[model samples]
Target: MSERTGWDRRLRVRADGKGLVGHAGVVLLRRCADQVGLTGALAAVLPVGVGHGWRERAAVVVQLAVAIALGAVNLSEAEQLALHHRNLFGPAASDSTTRRTLAALDESALTRMAKARRTVRRHVWSLLHLRPGGFPWLSVAGRRLKGWIVVDMDATVITAASKKERAAATF
Candidate 1:
């Protein structure tokens, strides 16, 4: 188990073609969050509930984010994280707890969360800048842009062979 988060870290990966665990990618995602200090940063900014048996708010938020990344559409679905992955995930917050945590976030709290995210982003970029090649450059239309991160949020449309109810032919 990890000393910082108390999550199990005994997972082993092998190509022996035996004892496969599905959705193991979540472990890597969780580790990345921990290594990047995102979990600690969010915990420092968020309010910790007063009383025993209360899980860390930041942990719950991170778990929910991971659940979403794993295709969970709602808080109830987030419970899937604890269903079969208890050993890997430790104790996950209940859906009601998640709802309450989200509901308790006011404007100020949201601002703090945003600031925390920005801080982490800056830290990560600084680390990237220290790499051998420095920050990566982007080339578009024969124009090379350095020291700038370009995010493309273009929407993609996929055509379906057969149309179904409430399903668009192309999306």
Candidate 2:
């Protein structure tokens, strides 16, 4: 019998060695964990006590994963990519599981996380040690030139849609 085998190219994990860190999957997992609580992540479910009912948090991650993959519409297709690349269990999520999980969230945890993130951006500016215009978005032209920063808003692609209509408002 030959000493070598076809499995030589296969990757193997070291049971006693350290595992991968800072990988995309690990980073995404950390973000999801922050969205829900760490405890919620381990459980992959939680109750917001907001009258919606029990909510499963893993779907939050799966849905985002699907979006990041791009062009994944149905749950099954999303699950396939999630399973192959991220090694997250996709086939385990059926339509019903997804539906119930969604129904369970009063508002999407993902959306809440997004909103919370926006608020957090302003927190840095609130620090006492940082004076006005010291945070860097401000320029040193305060006394010599325009002190205010101009913010431009455009909605060329943003739209508001409802179930009754595909797009209620578009810009």
Candidate 3:
């Protein structure tokens, strides 16, 4: 397998479906982070050696994020990214290392991290603006708003089983 920076191995699409890696789509997310400069921007804001020899704290954070996107609830579960797909994703930081990295983040570091994310977001939006459609528009109340994006941060709750006698079943 050929090695690539950011990605451990080059990925190819196959129609026959001879070999498939489960959860391989996470690679795309990692690639997106690398392409959009999220990885580098985060690394710039976060301190080096925070993971104690992991080298790239940004990668650890990104990996953890990817794992969470894949339904990982904790840091130990994030290790599955490397454990199962070592070829697609290179070495991953241990939970302890990840804990250290997170612990190293002070208020100032978090502020810097937020700033870095905003910077990368702006850069990505600028690139989108250069696209053929000239960025996407949001419509509200039949009015098209240019250069606007709406994000809905709503909370959702799901109950598996309730002990209450009068509880209704949720599908």
Pairs in clash, predicted candidate 1:
157-171
Most TM-score-accurate candidate: 1
Residue 110 error for model 1, in Å? 0.5
Lowest summed lDDT over 10 consecutive residues: which window, candidate 3? 1-10
lDDT digits (tens) for residues 24-73 of candidate 1:
77777787788888999999999977788898999888998888999999
Output the worst ten-in-a-row residue range by lDDT, candidate 2.
2-11
- For the record, the alpha-carbon RMSD of candidate 1 to the native fold, in angstroms, is 6.9
C-alpha RMSD in Å of predicted model 3 compared with the true structure: 7.5
By TM-score, how accurate is candidate 2?
Answer: 0.33
Task: Judge candidate 1 at residue 129 and give its lDDT.
Answer: 77
Query: Candidate 1: where are CA atoms >4 Å away?
Result: 1-9, 14-20, 135-171
**Against the true structure, what is each candidate's TM-score?**
0.70, 0.33, 0.69
* Local accuracy by lDDT, each model: 0.79, 0.45, 0.77
Give me the displacement of residue 121 in model 3, in angstroms: 0.2
Candidate 3 per-residue lDDT over residues 108-148, each given as its tens digit: 99999899999999999889778997655788799899767
